[model samples]
Target chain A: MNVLVQGVLLGGFYALLACGLSLMFGVMRIINLAHGDIAVIGAYLVWVLVNQTSMPPWLAALLVLPIMWVAGYVMYVLLLERSRRAGQLVPLLTTFGLAIVIENVLLQIFSPDDHSLLSSTGTLATSSISFGGLTISIFGMLTLATAVVVLIGLQFFLSRTTSGRQMRATAEDPDVAELVGINARAVYAKATAIAVAIAGLGGIFLAIRQTFNPSTGPTQLIFAFEAVVIGGFGSPWGTLLGGIVLGVAQVIGAQVNPQYFVLFGHLVFLAVLASPRGGLLSRRGRTV
Target chain B: MIRARGGQLSGGFRVQRWTRLSVVSAAVTVAVIVVLAVVPFLFGADVTEQLTSLLIFVILAVMWNALAGYGGLISVGQQAFIGLGAYGTIFLTQHGIAPYEAMILAGLGAGAVAVPTSLIMLRLRGGQFAIGMWVVAEVFGILVTLDAGLGGGTGISLNGLDVFAPGYRQAYTFWVTLACTTVLLGLVFFLLRRRIGTSLQAVLDDEEAAASLGVNVVRSKRVLFVVAAVGCGIAGALYLANTLFIQTTSVFGVQWTAYMLFMVLVGGLGTFEGPIIGAIIFYLIQAQFGDSGAWYFVGLGATAIAFALFLPHGIWGAVDRRLQLRLLPVGYTLRKLDTPASAGADPAATDT
Candidate 1:
């Protein structure tokens, strides 16, 4: 039961990391390989703010969110947009290059030392709440709550708001959306902005709960990517469930043998990929 | 669609495959090979070591070109095979086998493993495929760490190679790697020269259209994927033979893929000569700035992005545009016939 609780809580973090990736792919058919690195950058920004200004981590996080949003918007316009015009695969390669650049730059600046948001958060990071015969870390619960709130808010935004609807319309068919006076480029930029901001949120949460270094980005990316895949592509709520599944599988795998935790998660992802129910992505290579 | 067969002029035009330029290029290639083969006799361990690294990069660049450039599959997980090749050699050496023979077997073993993995990996398209391959590498890395015999992440070095003196061992390693490089290069050249090459081009253009035209898109991709795995696996084993170490972190590093990407993109994507040039340039850069660490990687990453964005065709592509040279002639070129009758046949022909 404890394992199950821990797993679900862990799933919340994965869901948080994955939502931005899902959103980017859903809106632009882009898989931003640098998604994890962007999240790390957010964390680093918040860290710098907290360290230099002696500001509260929460306030630092609040300040970083808008900055990340602006960064995302600009990044899309300047880098991704041009690469997209180049070719389908160019964006992916460009993002990978971006990831490498971000990681190494972080390393250069931070000097590979591990940092945790717990230092600024006092004892809140370790504090836990007992409920239904299970004790859970408050930080973990906070991350889960944030994930649920973000997903619900995103759902509402996409379904109800005019801008969100425009974004969806653009995603459905950019040409038709453009025909209808919707600026697809602007819509894409907005979507990218939202996605990247959310990724920053995930990063801030991750820093509170775990230690991170510059190289943490790739592992985070794999987990988030796995969640996206396991949940099925382009679905937000499904991503949450997928995250839970992955988290639970990993926790359970850890229970069996600590070393197999990550390996088991990868195996589960491969299993999901191999399963016939994988749908659109798995059914690819029809020409083969 | 018209392939030049070289040897004779057609329609009073010299639209042939093997031109004098090709012959000169071939001579240059052979001369380079001869020099490489005798490097141990001329230089110390350091030169041979650096040359071996160059050869490994060339193998990686060429194989990556085959996979992403020609096969239309961009994989970041090729390190899985490289890791396997490195660890497989260690595993075999621990089992009382000769390290030299183990390297070959390990490479072949990685290739054999690729056939099954491709079924799982090839399902993904575009970016998913790219990261999915990375996940596969992670999985392989974790699996290696699980077995105690494999060093459980601490990693092991090649045993049973102590019988060879340092000089002979270095020479043997260089020779074996050289031989493998030649064969793999030949294999890629051979594969590209066949009808499969055309089918691969068709698939790269439009998979559905290629399939409609009877091109086996899946087969072409799978073949290239497996070949890449084999090449990388061999490179890994060769790397092990050179360094005498086999650590999961280093062997399965993403930097290997980055190097491959740098070579392919910087030289020229989807071109035979491009990767070779890219690898050489990359080697030179590494030799110069390799010890600078993080800043070096930053520069590399920035350069790669610049190339991907602005010069998508890369350095070789720019040069080829001006020179119109085809050293390997894997691609076709169309030229007008020199005969007056052929010129007269075209009403809109320009008079020069």
Candidate 2:
């Protein structure tokens, strides 16, 4: 029972990791191979702020969010926008190049050593609540709450707000959106910014959960990608469900043997791939 | 068939498939291959090792180019095959097969794996296919790591290589690499000359159009995927032979795909000579800055970005445009008639 609960909470974190990826792909039709690296960079930013300025983790994350948003905007304007016109492969390669640069840059700066933000969190790192013969980490509860809040908030924003509707419009058809008086480029940039900011939040949760190094991006990417694929690509709520499925699988695999944890998740992903329906939550036969 | 008259029907012009430049390029290529084949005899172990590595990179770049450049399948999971090949060779040699012979078997083994892998991987398109390939690679990496006989994560070395002297081993490995590079390139060249190559180009240009025009898009893509897997597998075996070591992390690393991408994109895509130029340029760059650690990757990534943005067609594309050069002429160019007499004098050309 405790393992199941823990798995669900862990799923919340995985959902966070995947949300930005889902959002970016939903809006821009880009796979963004650098998505994981950018999240790592966000975590690094939080680490730098908390360590260098002696700020609280939450405070550092708060400050880092808008910065990441701007970073995303700048990345789009400087690199992705230009490559978008070249070909389908160009933008993917551009992001790949950016990932390599970010990871190597992080390695150069951090020296490949694992760093965790848990040190500064003190009680938050250790505190847990017990209920009905099961214990849950307080941080895990907070992560779950954050993920729910973010998902609902994004759902509302996309469905209700003007900018959100614009984003949806652009996502459905960029040229059509432009024809309907929506600035597709602006919508894309805004969507990217939001995606990056959310990824920054995911990064904070990741730092709190485990030790990470520069090279950890690719592993995180695989997990996030699996979660997204399982949930159904480009579906927000589906992403949350996918994360839970992946987390549960990993936890169950861990119960059998620690080595089987990641392997089981991969096996599940492959099974999903082989399924006739495509994915668990895929809406249409064609993916975003 | 001999109709002789006035200006209407005098003679026929012969279509030329081989240009003077192509002949010269072919001769130069053969000369280079001869020199490369004899490198181990002329130089010491270090130079031999470097040349072998270069040849391996060439093989990888060429194979990647064939898949992505011509077939339009931009897979990031080719490292999966590379790892499989290395592990396959290691497995074979452990079973008493000669190391040199095991390399060939390893390639076949990789191709065998690719057959089933393509069934799943080929169902995806565009970016989905790219990420799907990555997932497959991750799966392969984990499975390899889980196997206890393969030494798990710590990896294993090729033990049977010690049967030969160090000099003989180095030379033999170099010769194997040379043969692999020659055969792989020769295969690609021959494929481009065949009708299947034209179909591949058609598929790359537009899958729907090709499908409508009766091109077997699925078969062509599968063939390209298998060929690339075989080439990468052989490269992987050569890599293990040279280093005599195999690790899941190093062999199955995404860095291999990164290098392949950098080489193909920076050199030029969809050109026979592009990957060769790209691989040489990459070797030169790596030789100079490889020891710089992370900075080397940063430089490579930055260069790839710059090329993708500013020089989308790559170095060869620019060179080809400026010099009007085609090292391997797969496309036909109609010769213009310089005189009115020449226009009506070619009845055979009119039929073609």
Candidate 3:
């Protein structure tokens, strides 16, 4: 039962990382291979804000989120828009290039030293609450709550807001969306911005959870991918479910042997991928 | 039957398989191979080692091109096979097999692993397949790390090569590398000359259309995927032999994929000779600025991006467009019959 609770909390973190990826693919039809690197960059930004200005990590994250949002919009317009014109393969290669560039740039700046955001958070890093023969990290519970709230907010926005409708329209059919004066380009840019902002938030959560370095992006990428795949691609709610499943699998595997933690998660992902329905929750069947 | 400037024609045009230029190019390729085969005797171990690295790069670029360019199966997880081969080589060596023989067996072992992986991997398309492959590679690396016999994360070294003297080992490694590279290249070239080549090209152009037209898309893709895995595995095994050390981090690094992408993209995708040209250029650049560290990768990434966007066809494509040179032409071209009357006309008129 304790393991299940911990797994659920871990799943929340994975969901936070993956929802942005789901959103980007939902709208743009392109998987940002550099998604994790962008998140890493956001983490570094927050790190610098906390260290250099001596500001609180939460406040630094708030400042960096808006910056990431704007950067995502500009990046979509400048880099992806043009590269996507060439062909399907080019855009993927472009994102890969971006990933390499971002990772190496981080290495160049940070010198490959491991940094943890929790180091600056005093007792908040280790503080936990006990209930019914179970103990949970305060940060972990907070992350789960935050993930739930964010997903609820996103669900609301997608259903109710005008901008969200426009994003949906574009995602459904860009040509038709443009025909209806929805400004699909603008909608895509908006979607990118939202996705990137959320990715930044995920990065902050990741940094608080564990130590990170420049090369850490790819591993994060695989985890997010596993979550997205496990949840079923192109579905936001599915991402959450997928994350939880992955987290649970990982936790259970770790119980057997510590070395099996990541291996177990990966095996579960592969099993899901090999499944006839593509995912446990996906009714659409074999999207990838 | 009409006689064109080059060959006999069934109609007004002739379907030419080989041009005068192609014949010359083939001769030059043979001459170069002869020279390369004799490099161990002509130079020291350093030069032989450098040439071996070049051969491995060429092998990687060619294999990647065969998969991505011709088969439209862009995979970023090829390092899984490389790491497997490296460890497999060490495993075989520990089992009392000769290191040289172990490398070859390891490559085959990687190909065997690729068979099952392609079933799962081929289900994905475009970006999903690319990242899916990466996931596979990560899983393989973690699995290796779990095994203590493989040295966990640090990895192991091939230990059976001490019987041969240093110079003889160097010469033997060079010869094996040369033979492997040549055979692989020949296999790709031979495949391209067969009817399966056209089916692959059709698949690359459009999968559904090719499928509707009766092409075995999955089989062709599987063939290429398995072949590429074997090629990368051999490269990995050779790397271990050359350095006498194999590590999880080094063998399974994504840098190998990046190199493959750079070579294939910069050379010209879908062209037989493009990867060779790209590999040579990459070798030159690495020789010059390899020590620049992160900046070097940044530069490489940037260059690959630039080529992917602005120069999608790459350097060879530009040259091929202007010169109409197919140094190793696999596809047939139809040319108008150039009779004595049309000989004095514009040279462009000779090609229909």
TM-score of chain A of each: 0.95, 0.97, 0.97
lDDT of 1 at A104: 96
What is the CAPRI rating of model 1's predicted complex? high
lDDT of 2 at B36: 86
Model 3 residue A24 CA deviation (Å) reads 1.4
Query: Best candidate, lDDT-wise?
Result: 1
Once fitted onto the true fold, the runs of candidate 2 whose alpha carbons sit more than 4 angstroms away are A285-288, B1-17, B334-352
Per-prediction DockQ comes to: 0.83, 0.73, 0.78
lDDT of 2 by residue, A25-138 (tens): 888878788888888998999999999999999999989999999999998889878887787778878888898999999999999999999899898977999999999999
**Which whole-number lDDT from 0 to 100 does residue A21 have in model 2?**
85
Ranking by lDDT: 1, 3, 2
Candidate 2 TM-score restricted to chain A: 0.97
lDDT of model 2 at residue A80?
78
What is the lDDT for B5 in model 3? 36
- Model 1 lDDT tens row, B255-349: 88888888888998888899999999999999899999998998888888999899887888777767777788676655556577876654221
lDDT of each: 0.87, 0.86, 0.86
lDDT of 2: 0.86
Error of 2 at A221 (Å): 1.5
Give lDDT: candidate 1, residue B23: 77
lDDT of 2 by residue, B152-203 (tens): 9998999888988888899999999999999999998888667778788788
Error of 1 at B268 (Å): 0.9
